[model samples]
Target: MKSTLKKLLPFAVVGVISGATTVGVQQYFGHTSNNEDGSYFTTSKNVSFAGMNTSAVGDDFVAAAKTTVPAVVTIKNYQTKTSSRASEQDMFDFFFGDPTGRNQRQRQQQAPDNMPSGLGSGVIISPDGYIISNNHVVAGASKLEVVLSNKKSYIATLVGTDPNTDISLLKIEEKGLPYLNFANSDNLEVGQWVLAVGNPLGLNSTVTAGIISAKGRGIGILGGQGKAANPIESFIQTDAAINPGNSGGALVNVNGDLIGINSAISSTNGYYQGYGFAVPANLARKIVEDIKKFGIVQRGFLGVSSLDLSDDRQVAAYNAEKKTNLKVGSGIYVTSVTDDSGAQNAGIRTGDIITKIDNIAITDFADLSMSVGSKRPGDKVVVTYLRNGKENTSTVTLKDQKGGTSTRSKADLSVTEKIGSDFDPLSERIKTDYGLNSGVVAKNVTEGSEIAKIGIVDGYIVLEINGKPVNSQKDIERILDKYQGNVQVKFVDDYGRIYTKGFKMP
Candidate 1:
């Protein structure tokens, strides 16, 4: 019995030694294999990591790519150029670069019938060939063509466009198309996997994957750029490698749901630099629906010009000047309130700090813009604000730019409404001073209008439309009565620079 006990003790000692050696080796190497949560610990810094090895969790993007790629399509914009408008082409090239990217001067030096085209991308949103794309992508296009993933091409008709949101809706004559369903963008959280499907750089049906880096990002790419009047810019930021042609493409999640549309990129050289911005799916979907129903965006106006409180420098400056202890990142500081507007009627005055809309916190202009911009005129929103260090709430009814609470359909709009601008015949003295053959003065260029999106201002002088001299509003109505598709306008800016621009007829 003593000999058996001695032999068992030796085996126990051997087992203990082996266990100790294994533990010591593991500690020294800092390797942990039992971490089933896709995490690991290494000896390099005794640090733990997660989501570094995505293969462990099975990131099979094949299903997502298959579902998204078919819904994405390539868009081609064709424009006919005339030799007489070479200088005008230069202006267009300066504002919007030639999509073909060949030598503009060389192309301009070609025949008067030169047909230069641009390339972009689009996404089908309905099974009946209803598509959505960036307004800039199809803007000024004489002809738009959509190419499906299977190489089928079809001429597309422009349904409508909202420049404030940079969203455009187009319809092709086809049935049973692959489309993407809109997901609730408000549910999108940062760091979630997403895929960008588009025709980037003319690459057909290109797909790239990344994560949602941010939400409700306002980067001044939209109305903040001073081009779009009342720009709605609550963008969803992602690192999804969006490039030039990716504009108007689909930004979808792994479940193949559309959350946003790739719109702009943050880059120093006009290329992807790991930062991309998209129009949030919610805002975009609203714009498209409005356009489809009303033939225009039924945009609601909050009726106040304010400064973003999130801008530290601006907030500091305001607080110092106003002698108010305003907190940074609290909300927007109202600088001025529009007269006869809903905000003024609701007792919202200058110096009021708007904090929220409809119970949604307004951390910055982006939040406020999204909350209110999504609603149509006559929509009521509960506005929360701070005045004199006291919190207050008001249910405010939104109004249109004309200070009206009623909605207007396309048929209800007149010729001037369709043109989005009122005009007065140019005075003889003004025309003589400018040495113009025929001219008219543009007035009240409506915000978010097709002409406004083309950079036309309220005080610009209109010389021609469709190459015919426009001397009065009646002349414009006459010419546009028979005009179709792209309408060319020759105008002179305040500085007397003659520029010809094109915009699609609404």
Candidate 2:
């Protein structure tokens, strides 16, 4: 009996030592959560919330979920296309296989009926029904429907959209709705606990918790053809299990304040691969505010072609291109300052190393982009740079893409504002010479305007709208006010050039 008792004592001591070591490691990493009786349990090691209490990170996942889930909503985008019957050539090619057997030419004529509905998520930003969402989610959408956590639904209108930041503003008629306020994403630190609230994969009111894996991360996605035209991507990287349909949802801190908006994920198989990206709240808030106050976004451009020094490969390429032996380092390198742009106008020369903006350190191109992208045109920024190893400073006012320091606000203008154009009456003498009774002249061609995209410039006189005569600016408005997707605009320019352009309304 003594021999058996001694053997059991050794086994018990081993068990006790193993348990003690596990608890010590857990406490150090701050994965402790509270139970009902106030005892703590360790579940993870990545989250840490120091300064909140003498205790380790609080496991307040339930509190954040309850605060945010009600404001996150599912958005359904309904789009329709006119079905086109096969042409004789298409029919012949279908019956008898194409010569290349690839159907490349036939693919170009694809006009299908009832494109599949696209789904995403949105975060309500105000009790008066202003919601912030992803531009890609609702862009080109003919109809938008939002469903809340309580199962109540509402029809939403597109207040304004900015593809550059991939942020869109929407409004519903309802008042006193649940909303989440913005937190300073610039203040968010790495390893801080955060929660992602959204309807991912059609799972409504889902909340996932993780740590802020990184900040000022640029994934090299967005900003191209068929995507954001002038993409601003300085993503807050996390591992919060965001999936499809989480694009426009909220990424909140432990205090339930919005730190970011879940934008995209880094994966090879189209699923979470431990890397998810969010648009920082600071930049998103700027975009939402601009869209709300102005009819369009008031983006500020620094106007300098730069090399992202954060990337070693980009550094090597830049060195090779310019034949300079500069070392790869943090912050943005000014390769060339665009002529007459904000940078050049402010005397920012080539070969300058931009170190700070408004006193905030420019750690990388992402930092610079986010800092400048958040400001509007005509806003002044203090730029600190290194020239020949000496630090110098300059005050530069930002410019719009058109090189103009101006702001755009919505007027009680024609509905054609959706098409990004303003229409005015043509002069009677010119109209008589053109043998026209009345005509609406398109003016103020925005950079990305639909009419401008179809090769029509400002001063083009509109003669027809969808085959109906457009005698006045209101005529063009009345014809397009009810049209959802695209309409045909036939016009004549000042150079006596007659052309028909297709304008798509956003």
Candidate 3:
């Protein structure tokens, strides 16, 4: 009886050990499933799952891209052909070289029946369909189409364009569209992560990421008529791989906030070669707001031309001329002031080296420009400058591009004091030499006249009425008398150069 009991105990112990080993293996492999009471276990060979630990970098970037890409859009523009003269074709041929020198034959042949087409990128700025893009993208375009990531295309209307800043605003008819909010570009620090979203090379909704390479970099690319000199070129440089078609796209922070508009690139091959430039969203916002309010950007200018402090010789000469003991290592040296610019009005002289604006240190011309541009016309700002080794502060009211105190009045002679037109007519020799048939010569300018107030001097010859040739004083008087309100006059100086000035007649 004892041997039988021992044999049963050994068998029972072996069965219990084998069952425990099976349960351990099933638990480690996650193949065992249990009920709430822990009394039942089940396993299915066909059901399988696996997972791995991932990093937050991938998830955060992916989420940012998803949020930003939808607000980035592809802008397609079409400029209508107004003439079939083949002037553009001839110009193209002159540089590109005609395969067959039959330039005459090509010119005689009918020009392409279609309009010129171009593509770029834009950022949706408002949910009600206001989009912002570079002016060059939609300038002179007869038709503009904006396409979103959701495959919805909307025709956009050009609200306004500021060529000085290369910013243009457009409005789409659709409402409640996805848009991106702007970040304070002034707060962006070097080395912050940024993402560039655009239609690079027509590749729609492409995003490239990199850190901010620099801030306040001036590339000297933008310039044209009535366009102020490239004053505000404090671009935020990045390595975000902005390509040709990426112009007007958004350069966003990692949190999906728009900080800048991707503008130009330092490239030799016309493609991304690492260096890229963007207009700060702060400046862009000001320009966009100005263009939206007025048909053009109403920018405030100090009206003083300045040279970089890097030009030591010029700095020294300026110091000597102005009799100032300013150390020539920093700050902008004012070279000349326009006759009636804000600086001139504020008694800011040519020799004054602007050292600070609103307590912010002015390191160079770019700094001054950015500071001034940040404010609208009529906004008063404090300018601290060094003159004759003495620091002086002035509270100067900003003026618009047309040399006016504010942008409220659009009258041609709003800011100018109109001088009475009591002047001797231009002589025949002076007319022949100046290449004008006839016109009235500005002999005496009164102090209260708009011309005198804005710095137009006596002795300037009126050359054209509207744009037509004015051969006599009768012609000038006739044009002015006929146009009772505001009129634009094209006049030639004694040296024969022509300039256009607008004035309101009494």
Q: What's the C-alpha lDDT at position 357 in model 3? A: 94
Worst 10 residues of 3 by lDDT: 10-19
- For 169-258, candidate 1 gives per-residue lDDT tens digits of 999998899999999999999999889998765567888888899999887655533336688888888988876678889999888889
lDDT of 1: 0.75
Summarize candidate 3's per-residue lDDT along 1-506 as a digit string, tens digits.
00001111111101000001111332422432234443323357844223522345446567779889999888876544432222223222322345554432123222233423456789999898889988656643557788898889888887866555667789998878889998999899998878999876556899888889999876555531112244467889999878656888989987899999987776433345678888899999888777666655667777778877855776788678978655657788787988877788889997788889999888876688789877877888889998988999988888876667767523333212122444456677876766666666664443223343222345677666567766555566555553567667676643455777665664
Model 1 residue 194 CA deviation in Å: 0.5
lDDT ranking, high to low:
1, 2, 3
RMSD of 3: 24.5
TM-score (all chains, Cα) for each model: 0.76, 0.69, 0.66
**What is the C-alpha lDDT profile of model 2 across 370-427, one tens digit per residue?**
8898888899999999999999999999998768888867553247656766778778
Worst 10 residues of 1 by lDDT: 10-19
Q: Which candidate wins on lDDT? A: 1
Q: Which candidate would rank higher by lDDT, 2 or 3?
A: 2
Clashing pairs in 3: 416-450, 417-449, 417-450, 418-449, 418-450, 419-449, 438-471, 438-472
Name the regions of candidate 3 deviating beyond 4 angstroms.
1-54, 82-116, 224-231, 311-328, 339-341, 409-506
Error of 2 at 251 (Å): 0.7
